[model samples]
Target: MGRWRPPAEKKSKYITATGYKRMNDELKYLWKVKRPEVTQAVKEAAAQGDRSENAEYIYGKKQLREIDRRVRYLSKRLDDITVVDRIPDDQGTVFFGAWVTIADEEDNEQRYRIVGPDEIEASGQLISVDSPLARQLLKKQVGDEVYLQKPDGSEIWYEVIAIEYEPY
Candidate 1:
């Protein structure tokens, strides 16, 4: 088999104000603080005799490449994204940046914030707007039910119990 792979699907460009700020902050830190520090380390390492066997020089160069890659990606993403700073007029409906609380038939509830793909967190509280759950929840008002079919062929339903624009 070849090492070739298909291109990834394009991600949505809508980002909340907080998420945009976070991305910008990361870009700035990587470009301003981190890059200069690594450059200096690499320079010092290069000055010390032979570079072929110099572990510090090789490691520093690798770190520089990774940092530059991230910086470039963040810069382009920031320029392309649209920042959603204001809350929507319809507070009762699920929309971007809204904190939605959903409940299953058993009354088990979970809260999630609809954010851009870049802002999806490991905490599970933030979900990308392009996600299946968020797509079904969009424009849905409180008391509305959302149906989703899992990849495993199981079906589940969730009722929108509450929707808030502000973070809790």
Candidate 2:
């Protein structure tokens, strides 16, 4: 059986100032604090001898590998990102960093902050710029209707209710 896979599409390089700072802070913490602590633990575990039977040594190695992987990803992503701190001249229209309110056919209003892929948090309603819904909302002004074709081949409609951008 073949294991070939298609290449992933490129993500937009735009990032809000807050998102940029957060990513940098994570990179700094991983490199200066977490990496060193993990390294020390691995060293101590290795010193205990009989590595094949040493559970602590194996766990330490695995943990170090995961940390290193994250560090590399953060470093590369930071290099590619462009910090967008300026508000668009036309604030009425949707753009990056805009907090947008959208209403569906049933009048259910959903609020989302369009942010960089790296800044998406589990607790917040932040959508990536590369997302299909975000792409449809970009450059759209209040009262403009958006029709999105779902993966299941169904079309859903939404109307832009409001747009706001906070100063960075």
Candidate 3:
């Protein structure tokens, strides 16, 4: 088999101001604080004789690689990101950085915040602006019905209940 794969498609460059700031802060911390500490640790580990059998050296090298990878990604992303700081003129409609509440056909309400991909956290109800749901929600007003076709071939419908852009 060929050890090759197609390159991934480019994502949207739009980002919320808060997301931009958070990513910038993370990049700064990684480059200025974490990188130095890890580099120092790796240097210390290298001084402990043969690296082949040195567990600390191996672990430090792996950790350094991971941190460097993240730093590089953040650098490139920050350069391309366009920060959206102001709220949309139409508060009644969904747009980037809007907190949206949607109700399914069964009357179950779900809330999500549309944000840049970099700002997505596992603990929050944040959705990527490029996501299917977010794409459908954009420019949609309250009481509008949205029909979303899932990747699995099933379709789902949602009604916009509320939309707002608030400071986080």
Candidate 4:
């Protein structure tokens, strides 16, 4: 069976100043260090001959392809990104770059930074602003109830505990 998925995530042109800097740094590191290192490895592997049977060659080539793909994606993303350098005037509503705390029906507290899809990372509870949950949370204020209609004919309920634009 195929896995379920939301539509392709679309990111806003505006990113927080810190987010922009992190993306820029990643792109720079990939191009200046990782890209060249992978290219060199691929070349070295190729020089050994018999690439069809060469595991190193195959892996190097695959890694290089993946790196190049990301490099290109970051290039386009950076160009499109606006880099929201200043905070917005809205304080009561949840929007892009907002830090939100919510409690589910189970009384489990969750904190997440709503950010562009390109900025998501596992280290932090970062939710893509374009996600279904984020979409429901957007424009909502503290004390507002949000109900997410899931695919399994069930709904998840959450109440906004706090919504602040400050970056964490």
User: TM-score per candidate, in order?
Assistant: 0.96, 0.94, 0.92, 0.80
- lDDT of model 2, residue 163: 99
Model 4 residue runs over 4 Å out of place are 1-9, 49-53
Against the correct fold, how does model 3 do in TM-score? 0.92
Find the candidate with the highest lDDT and give its number. Answer: 1
Candidate that would win on TM-score: 1
lDDT of 3 by residue, 47-82 (tens): 989999999989999999999999999999999989
RMSD of each: 1.7, 1.7, 1.7, 4.1
Per-residue lDDT for 1-168 in model 4, tens only? 899888974656767788888888998999999989988998998999999999999998898889889989989989988776656688888877888999999899999988877778887689887788888998999999999998998999999999877743
Return the clash pairs for model 3, or none: none
Clashing pairs in 4: none
Give per-residue CA lDDT, model 2, range 47-154, as digits (tens): 999999899999999988999999999999999989999999999999999999999999999999999887888876899998888999999999999999988999
- The candidates, ranked best first by lDDT, are 1, 2, 3, 4
Residue-level lDDT of model 1, residues 1-168, one tens digit each, is: 899989989999999988988999999999999999999999999999799999999999999999999999999999999998888877988889999999998999999999999999899999999999999999999999999999999999999999999742
Candidate 1 regions off by >4 Å? 1-3
For candidate 2, the TM-score is: 0.94
For model 4, where is the 10-residue window of minimal lDDT? 8-17
